[model samples]
Target chain A: MRTPLCDRFGIEHPIFAFTPSEHVAAAVSRAGGLGVLGCVRFNDTDELERTLSWLDDNTDGKPYGVDIVMPMKVPTEGSSLDLGAMIPEEHRRFVDETLLKLGVPPLPEGEGREGVLGWLHSVARSHLDIALAHRPVLIANALGSPPVDVIEKCHEHGVAVAALAGAAKHATSHVANGVDIIVAQGYEAGGHTGEIASMVLTPDIVDAVGPDVPVLGAGGIGSGRQVAASLALGAQGVWTGSIWLGTEEYRSLSSSAGWETAFLRATSSDTVRSRVYTGKPARLLKTRWTEAWAQEGAPAPLPMPLQNLLVSDAHNRINASGDPDVVAMPVGQIVGRMNQVRPVAEVMAELVAGFDEAVAGLEKVRG
Target chain B: MRTPLCDRFGIEHPIFAFTPSEHVAAAVSRAGGLGVLGCVRFNDTDELERTLSWLDDNTDGKPYGVDIVMPMKVPTEGSSLDLGAMIPEEHRRFVDETLLKLGVPPLPEGEGREGVLGWLHSVARSHLDIALAHRPVLIANALGSPPVDVIEKCHEHGVAVAALAGAAKHATSHVANGVDIIVAQGYEAGGHTGEIASMVLTPDIVDAVGPDVPVLGAGGIGSGRQVAASLALGAQGVWTGSIWLGTEEYRSLSSSAGWETAFLRATSSDTVRSRVYTGKPARLLKTRWTEAWAQEGAPAPLPMPLQNLLVSDAHNRINASGDPDVVAMPVGQIVGRMNQVRPVAEVMAELVAGFDEAVAGLEKVRG
Candidate 1:
C-alpha cells in the first residue's frame, strides 16, 4: 500500500521494520519496505560499524534506517565495578539463584556478556555517527525525540529522523523537536511501550501532529490485514518489529536455540508487560524467568541499564542453556501469528497480498 | 457497511452499541445500529422489568439487545452480613480513610448501597428472565460463555447469544458451548478485559472461531475508520462501548455529575486497569481513588463480588460528590476521541460516513 511516506522514502510500501539483525534489515529493504536496524544490541561500536558496512554493500543500493535507544542515564566507561556496586546484594542473589533454579549453565569460554554499555546515550550517539557515515535514508530513536541538534545533524546528512511516541502529547513534542515521522507505539508493542493501544494511539497522534507528519501505527500488528488497519487509523504507514523475529534471515544470523521456538509456541495472551526485562515495562515472552520475577519473594526490578547489567549474565546463560521455555526475549502479543519460519521476501509478499484482500473485502460490504 | 450480521439481525449496519441507559439504546436502534442495553445496573427486578417494557414500547419497533454480567458466585438471599464479614477490617478502614481524604460525602438518606446484590448470578438470571419477557433480539454475557443451559434458554426464547472473549482459546470454548457470536474484547476495552489487545486478539479469535460464527471487534473503537479496521481484521461487526459515555441521550437520562465530564477530559492514557473497581481488572478513569488502591499500604483488592461489595458505598459517595477527576467509571482508551457530546443519530451517521471514507482511501492505495 502506497502512502505519501512511500514516495518520501523512495520505498514501494510504507512498512518500516525495526530489527537488530542486519540481514533481516537488508532483506526488508530489498522486499520493498524500509528496514530499520536497531543498534543497542551491538556489543562494540566496531562491530556495529562492520555490520552497517556489510548492509550498505548487500542491500542492492536500497535505502535502510538505523535505530538507537537513549538510556535514562549513561554509564561511564571502565565503571563496571561501580555499576555493580549500585545493585543490592539481595537482587543479585535472587538473579543468581533463579539461574541455578532454572538449571541454566554458565556460558562457554570467551563469550562476553552483552552488558549495559549499549544502553548509554553516548554509545547511541556513536551509533548515530557511524550510521550517518553510511548510506542510510532514515534514523529513529527508541526512547523519544532525539535532541533538536541531533535532528538537525541528521537533516544535514539528508536523512529524516523518526521518533516513537506512546501518547498524543509525546507525538506533539516529537513533532516540535523536528522529528520527521512519528511511530505511535502502543502498550501492546514489544520492548518499551506506553499504555494506549494502536487503534486509539495512531489516530490521536495523527490528529495531534497534523497531516504533514506521517504517523506509523505500531504494536500488535503482524498481518497485511493489520497493515491495512494501520492505514485506516489515519496512519500513513506501519512500524513493525516482532514479526521479523521469526524470519529465515534472522535465524541465519542469530542462535535459533530457544529464540525461534519461543515465538512459535506463543499465543497472544502469553506475553506480559513487565519491568524485569529492561528495567522498563516491555512486553516479553512469558517464561519461568518472568513468572519467577513476579513471585512474592522476588525483589522489585532495578531501574534501567542497571537492571540489564545485573541480568546480562543470566540472560546469556539462559540463551546458552538452549531451553525454549525459559529464554528471555522481547516480543509482542502478535506472537500468536508468528507460527512459521519463512523467508523475509515471502512474508513481505503475504503482507502486501493480505492488505489487498482486506481492502477488497471491505469493498464488498460498501453497499 | 453491510456485513452478513446485518442481514442475520435485520439491521442497517454491523455496529453494535452497548449502553446502560435505555433511552440511549432506543436512540441507537432508531439510528440503524444494534443498541444493547446493559441490565446489571437495575437494582430491582421490577425496575428492570419496567425498563425492558419501556424498551419494548419504544425503539420505534426496531430491534434491541440486553447484556448481563454473570458473577462468579451467586449471593444467597439475606446474606449481606455474611458477605460483609468476608472483607477484612483493615481493608474496610482503608476505604473509609480514602473517602475522607478525598472529601467524598456519603449518599443521601434512604438511598441504599446498591450492595453486592447486582453482582450476584441470581440477579443476572432475573435480569435475563425479564429481558426474555421483552422483545430483545440478542442477549450477551459480559463474562465468558454463559452456562450451556443459559445459552439453550436464550435460544429457546428465540434470542441469539453473544459472549465477550479476550483470548483465542476462550473464543473457541465459547463456540464449543454454542455461543452464536464472539466479541473479542481486548485489554483496551473498558471492563473486565484480557491482556491481549484488539489488534492481535481480533484476528486470532477470528481465525480460531472460523467464519461461520460472527466475531465483533471490541475495545478502543469509537470512529468509523476503526470500525473499518475491525472489519479488515476479520470481525463481522464492531462492539462499541466507551463512546456512549459522552452521548447526548445518556446525559439526558442520567445526571451529568462527573460521569460525562470525566470521559470528555480524558487523553487515552488517563485510564488504568485496576481490580478495585469490580474485584476484576477493569479499565477505568484513573483517579486518586483508583490510585490509592495501588499505593504501598493499601490492602490488596478482594476477589469478585467482595471488591464490588467493599466499594459500593464508596462508589455511591464518589458519584454523588460530583467531582469529575475522581469519578469511578468503566471506559475504554477510545475516551480520548469522545471530545464532543453528540446525539446517537449523529454519531451513527458519522460512523457510517467515516467508514465510507476509510474504505475509499484504501482504494486509492491499491495501485
Candidate 2:
C-alpha cells in the first residue's frame, strides 16, 4: 500500500498539495500528506520566514516544502547580459507608452515595492536560504530548470530538490540536474504549462524516465481515481494545484477566485491559455485580459520580468475591481470539474474513495 | 496539383482509401473532401451486379465511397479482439475461465456486434450494391459508428460519405446516416477518434480500408510548419482533430481536442485519452489522460458496442476528453501542435516536402 514517493519523502500518503498559503500546507501535512508552498507570490525572506513559522506552529512538525520559479532562458530583448543594464531605452519607452495607452496608474514615486518580476532570483534565493534554515523537507523550482546555484545550495542543505516539468525532456533535465522529484504537469494544470495534455504526458514522462526518480503527476488531477491512474502509469504520486484554489485556506478564495469558479463550472469552451498574465502562456479562466492579447494586432508581451511588471498592477486593480472579465487567474482546463470547495482532508479522502470506486467499477465490468 | 480522388469524384484530390476493398461509394467521393462510402467488409448484401457496375461508372461522375472495420478499442486482455468470432467453443470457454480469474471482456458474442457496430452493417447490406447503383462520392467509418442501411442506400444514389472519429461525438449518427467522406484517423486529429495510435492504425486501415475513402487527418497535425508537423500529427489535411486544428473548424475540434498541443506542446509529458476514447475512456495523448489513468490498476477496457451502447458516448466523450485526461484523442496525441496545418492546399504540399525533409534529417536527430 505504500507509494514509492511516500517511502522516499518519508510521508504516510503520496498526495502533494501545492498552495501559496501556510494554513493549507499545515493542514495537508497534518492530514498525512505533503504540502508544498508556492514561492512566487511571497514578497521577501521575511514573508517566507513568517509563513514557514506559521506552518511549523500549525502542523506541529509535519513535513512540507517550498516551490520557486526558475527559468532556462533569460530575456535577451530588454536588458543587456546584465538584467538591469539591459532594459533598452526603446523598450522602456514602449512600456511607458503601453501603460499610458491602457490608462494604468503609475507606481507612487519612491514607493519601496520592487518592480514586479524584479529581484525574482534574489528573492527566491533568499527564500531558499530561509527554507534551508528552517529544515524543510523539499525545495521546488517552478517555470523551468533551477539555476546551478539554487540546486547546489539546496544540496548543501540536504533538502530534496524538485522541479516541475511540462514535458518528458524537462523531467529528464530535472533528474540530470540533480532534482530528486519531477512533477509531470499537463496543460489542464493551473498556472504556466506546455501544450502537451496530461493524459499523454504522464506515460511518456514515465516511459522516458522510468522507475528510478519518483515522478509526480500534476495538473488537472483532483481526485483519488486520477491519482490511481497516475500511479498506474508509473507516477509515484499526484501533485495537485487547482483543488486547493477553492479551499478555505487559499488567500484568494474569500473573493471567489475567478479561475477556480470558472474552471469548476466551465464546459469545454471556456478555458484558454494566454500570455496576458506573465508573457508565457498559462491556462486560466478565459477573460478579457486573455482576449485582449489574443486579438489580431496586439504586440506580444515581453518574457517574465517585463511581462510580469506590465501586468502586476493590472492584476491587482482587476482583483480590487472584482471584474471577472479582466482578472487573470492561472488555472488548468481541469478546473471545469472542481465545482466545490472542501477541506484538504476531505479532498484527500475523496480521492482515495474515488480511486477505490473506479477500481471496483473496472472489476465489475470485467466480471 | 490534382489527386486521384479529385479526378475520380471530379472534385479536388485523390485520397479515397479505407474499407475492406468491399464498399467503395463514399470512399471515392470523400476521398477528395467531398463524399463518403459505406462499409463493404462483411459482405452482407445481394444484387452485387448493379451496385458494383453503377458505382464503378458513377462519378457525378465522381469517385464513389466504401468503409469497413477499424476497431477503436484494442483488447487490453482476454485475447485480441481480432482472432474473429469463429474461435471454437473451447476458446470461448477459455475466455470465460479467464474472466473467472482476472475478470474482463464484457458482452456476449451474439449481442456483440449489433446495428452499425456489428460486422453485418459494415460487411453486408450490399453497400456495394447501392454504391454501384448511385456511384457515390466517398466512403468511410471506423469501429465507433456507421450503420449498414446508410452505406447501402448511398451506393444506390452514387453519393459519397465518410466516417471515422476517435471520439464518439465526432462519430455522430448523422455522419453514418449518409456521408461522402471517410477518414482513417489518429489521436492528433481535431475530431472524435478511437484510442488506437494513428501510426499503428493509419497503416493498418490503409490496408484495412483499401485505398478507397482516402483517409485524411486523424490526429495531431504538426506543421505546413507541421505537414512539417504531420511529418508528425500523422494524417492529411490535419483533419485537424483539435480545436483550432483550424480556427474555422473550432466547434468540431474543441469538443474532444483542447489546447494541450495548441498552446503548450512543450509542457505536456505525453498524451492518451483512455476509455476517454468513447465514454469507454481510451487513452489520449494528454491533459486528464496522463493524470487520470497513468497509474497502477486503472480502469479496464469495456466491450465496445455494450460500453457506449449503454453510456452516452458522443456527449460524454465530448465533455470528458477535453478535460485534462478523462477524455481525449479521437485521433492521436501527435496532433497537439496541429494548431495550424495552414490552408488545406499548403498542408498537402507541405506533407510531401516535409516527409522528404524528415527522412533526410532522420540521421541527425537520431542520436
Candidate 3:
C-alpha cells in the first residue's frame, strides 16, 4: 500500500486523516497514517501549543500535520472588531430570530464559544506560528491558497505546505504560490468547498499542475475503494475528513454537544451546501438552523468573517443546548457511510484492507 | 486497453462515443469503439430507420448503439398537440421577442429544421422502436432511466439497456428497474444533467449499483487520462459526448449552423448550465441567448416539453441565421480541450494511446 507519499511522510499508508480531536490524530499517526490536526478549533496559543506538544509526545515522533483555515481573500479586513462592526444589523437580527424560532435555548453562563477566533486571519497566523514550532511534517490551509509568506515560512522550517483547492485553476495558483501539496477537495467535502466534485477535480488538478506536484483527493471519500479511485485519478494519496467524525474518538467529543447520534443517523442526502454556516458553501447536516437560512426571503448570508460572527452565538447556544435537531454540524455526504463508531486504529486497518482489496480487484479486471 | 466492456460490445476499446452524426457513429465503430447514434434528432421513424440501416451497412459488422432522450419524467405528459397548447402566451412571446432582440434571421425557404422532434416522448418512442428493429447492441436513455416496458422490450431483443443518472440513488433505482448499465453523468457533462459533478457521482453510482453492474463514467471527460481516471473509479467504460462535438464529422454538420468556429475557440470555462435550450439544466456554450435568459427578471424557463416547444422556433431561427454569438450549442467543459478538428479514427487512436500512457504513468507511481 506504500507509495512515494507514504515514504515522503514516513507513514505506513498514504491515507491522511484530518480531525479536530488530538486523540484521533495521535491514533491515526500511531497506526502508520499521517494524522492532521485541524488548528481552527484552538483560540488560545497556549492551548494549541499544549495540544501539539501532547501529540508530539504521544505519537513517539511519527509524522503528523496541522490544518489551518487561512483563506487567501476574506470578506472582512482589519482587526476582528472592525469586521464585527461591518456586519449588518439586519443579518444579526435574522440569525437571532431564526434561532429563536427554532426553539434553540441560550448557552449556560460562563461557557464561552470555542474556536471563534480561528475565523480571523490574525488568530490563524498565531496558530500557524505555533504549528511550525512543533516540528510538524506538513501545514495545510483548509480554505484556499496559503499566503506567500506562510508557504515560504513552512518551506523554511522544512515543512511541506498544502492548500485545498476545489478547481484546477485554484490548484494551479496554489502551485504557483509555492504550495508543496494540493488537496483537490470536491463539492461533497465537508466545510468550505467549490462547485467541482472530487473525481473530476483531482484529475483536473493533477493535469493542471503536472505530476511533479502531488495532489491529494478529498471530498466524499470514506473507504478503501474511494482511496483506490483517487490514486487511479493520479492523486498521490487521499485526504479524508468526515469519516473520522463518526469514529469513537470524535463521538467522545461530539457526545457533549449531543451530535454523535445525529451523525450516526444521517445519510448521504442529509447534508446540504449552505452559506449560512460560514458565508461560503459548506456541506453540513440539514438542521433547523440550515433550513431557516435557506427559507425564502431569509436575509442573505454575509460574507466570510461577518457571517461567521453572526452565527457564532447561535452555534454555541445550539451546541450547549444539546439539541440534535438544531445543532450545526459540518459534515460530508460520506456521513452516510459512517454508520458505526469504531476506534481510529480499527478504521485505519479497515482502510488499508479495503484499499488492498480494491487494487487487487482492479488488477483482476485488467487481467 | 480492453476490458470486459470491450468484449461485451466486441470493440477494441472501452470508449463509447455519443454523437448525432451517423458518419461519426459509423467511423467510431469501425475504429473499434462503440458508436452510439443520438436518435433525438430523428423525429421521423423512417429517417431514423434509414440512418441505422446505413450505419449497419457501413461499419463492417462493428457494434453500435442507439441513444434516445426518454426522461423518466417530463413536465407535460399528454400528446404533443395537447402539451403544445399548455405553453403560455407570454412564454411564447418572450422567446420570439428575445430572438428579435438578438437580430437572428429567419430560416431560408425549404430549409426545414432538423432534430426538433427529439423533445417529444412520442417521437422518441418511434425512434426507439426503429432502433430495436435494426439489431443495435445497446439502447441508452440519454436523460433518465428507461421506462420498465422499454427495458423489457430491449431485453426481449437481446439489446443491453443503459440509463443515465446523476446521483447514486438514481443509479440504484435504475438498476432495480433492470437497467443493464449505468451511465453516471455529472454536472460538467453536456445536455441535461444533475447538480452532482462527474467525479463524485461516478463513484457514488458505482458503489450504489455495486460491482456486479457495470457503470460508465460520463461528463467533462475528453482525453485518455480521464479514461484512466474513470477506470480507476471502477467504471467499466466512459460514455463521451462533448468531445465528439468538435470532431471533423460534427464540424461538417456544425459549419452550416455557424457553430463550428465557436466550438473550436471555446475554453473550459466558456460553458454554463442553463435551461434556455431544452428547459433542462444542460451545460452549453455561454452565448448571448443563454446569457439573456440568465439575466435578472428573465422569465424562469418553463418545464421540459413546454420549454422545448416555446424555444423550438427561436432555436430554429438562431441556427438558420448562422450567427456564432446567439446559437444555442450544447457542450461541456471539455470543449476547452477540443481546440481543433480531427477525424473520428484519429480521435479514437489518441484515446487508446492516452489511456495506455496514463495507465503506464500510474504503474510508475505505484512502483
lDDT of each: 0.88, 0.53, 0.82
Q: Name the lDDT of candidate 1.
A: 0.88
lDDT of 2 by residue, A1-367 (tens): 2565676777777888888777888888888889998877776567778888877788867789888776655434332235545445654565455545555445455532444442266666667777787867888777766876778888888888888888787888877878788888866577787766554566567767777888887865766545544554456778888778767667533443544455556532356767766767777777666676676666667766666765565566555445455557776644545667777788877766665554443222212
Query: Which one wins by DockQ: 2 or 3?
Result: 3
* Structure candidate 3, residue pairs in collision: A199-B199
Q: Candidate 3's residue-wise lDDT over A19-85, tens digit each?
A: 9999899999999999999988787889999999999999978999999998776434676667777
For every candidate, C-alpha RMSD to the true structure in Å: 1.7, 20.9, 2.7
**Model 2 misses residue A353 by how many Å?**
0.8
**In model 3 chain B, where is the ten-residue run with the lowest total lDDT?**
B358-367
The sequence of per-residue lDDT tens digits that candidate 2 reaches over residues B77-184 is 222233234234543343244333432234434534322333332333344345445444444545544455655555666555466654223434434355444454
- Extract clashing residue pairs from model 1: none
DockQ of each: 0.85, 0.05, 0.37
Per-candidate clashes, comma-separated: 0, 200, 1
